[model samples]
Target: MDLIADILLAAGALGAGIYCLVLGRRLNRFNDLEKGVGGAVAVLSAQVDDLTKTLSSAQNTAAGSAQTLTDLTQRAEEMSRKLEFQMASLHDIPDTPAREATATPAAPVSAQTTSEPMFVRHRAAEAHQ
Candidate 1:
């Protein structure tokens, strides 16, 4: 009876040792997985920061471009107004040289001579007459 009891005690001790070994391996694997997760989180945080900076720069550049376009449009409109005024003033210039060139006095012509034939359709005479 003593010999059988000793054999059973030895078998129990061996089983406990194997269980502890397996538990230790599992703990090590869990620690390794935790370290991998931590590394991945650090890399992702850095990438997020880089993306944020790029977005801010793009926003500033877009705002500046919009302002420049607005200013250029205003300048173009002003130039168009000045050009219109200059064109209106140009209509009065044809008689200036004639006034300056003629100095001799002459008798007035008859109304018949003053009225000439119409080069195109006489819309000017028709509307006034």
Candidate 2:
């Protein structure tokens, strides 16, 4: 009976030792995993910071572009108004002299009939024809 008890006790001790070894190894692995995760978090934080900076720069650029576009639009509108004003002013000019000039007639052919030479008479006759 004593020999059997000693053997049982030794077997239990061996099992407990094995369990502790495995548990310690597992604990070490968990610690290593924790360190790896911490490193990854740091890297991610740096990446986020970089992304934030890039976003800010992009926003600033967009604001500047919007301002430039606004200025260009205002200039275009001003130019359009000036063109409209010039066109309106042109419509106010009088056409009376133009109409009178177009209405006036040449001298009568009978008045210059004798003084005109042969070529002029020929042209006049051609025009009359």
Candidate 3:
């Protein structure tokens, strides 16, 4: 009976030792720097750093663009206000000249003296003559 117990214990120890050896090998592979989880983690870490830098640069560019857009919007608003003021001033002007108001009405030209259409400067002087 003692001999049988010793044999069973020895077999169990041998099996445990074999299991430990296989586990150690698998653990080594899992942590391998070139082809396992360790390599994947390293690659991911590098990508995160690159993305962080890119994101920061993009944020800065967006901020600059926003500031520029704000400035342009302000300038456009100022121009619109100036245009409105100019349009308001345009309403103050008279449609007819003051000289025309004081002048007497001219005689109508007959088609007998002129043939085709013509434009003459200083028509008031010619009308007096």
Alpha-carbon deviation at 105 in model 3, angstroms? 15
Task: Show model 3 residue runs off by greater than 4 Å.
Answer: 1-3, 96-129
TM-score, candidate number 2:
0.48
Cα error, candidate 2, residue 85 (Å): 0.5
Clashing residue pairs in candidate 2 (N, C-alpha, C atoms within 3 angstroms): none
- The candidate maximizing TM-score is 3
Model 2: lDDT of residue 101: 53
Ordered from best to worst lDDT, the candidate numbers read 3, 2, 1
Better of 2 and 3 by TM-score: 3
lDDT of 2 by residue, 80-127 (tens): 999999999989875557767578865575875777565544577778
Model 3: lDDT to the true structure: 0.90
Each model's lDDT: 0.80, 0.84, 0.90
Q: For residues 1-129, what per-residue lDDT tens digits would candidate 3 score against the true structure?
A: 999999999999999999999999999999898999998999999999999999999999999999999999999999999999999998987566778846955446485367765765888898998
Q: Can you list the residue pairs that collide in candidate 1?
A: none
- Highest lDDT model number: 3
Cα error of candidate 2 at position 43, Å: 1.9
RMSD of each: 9.8, 10.2, 9.8
* Candidate 2 C-alpha error for residue 38, in Å: 2.2
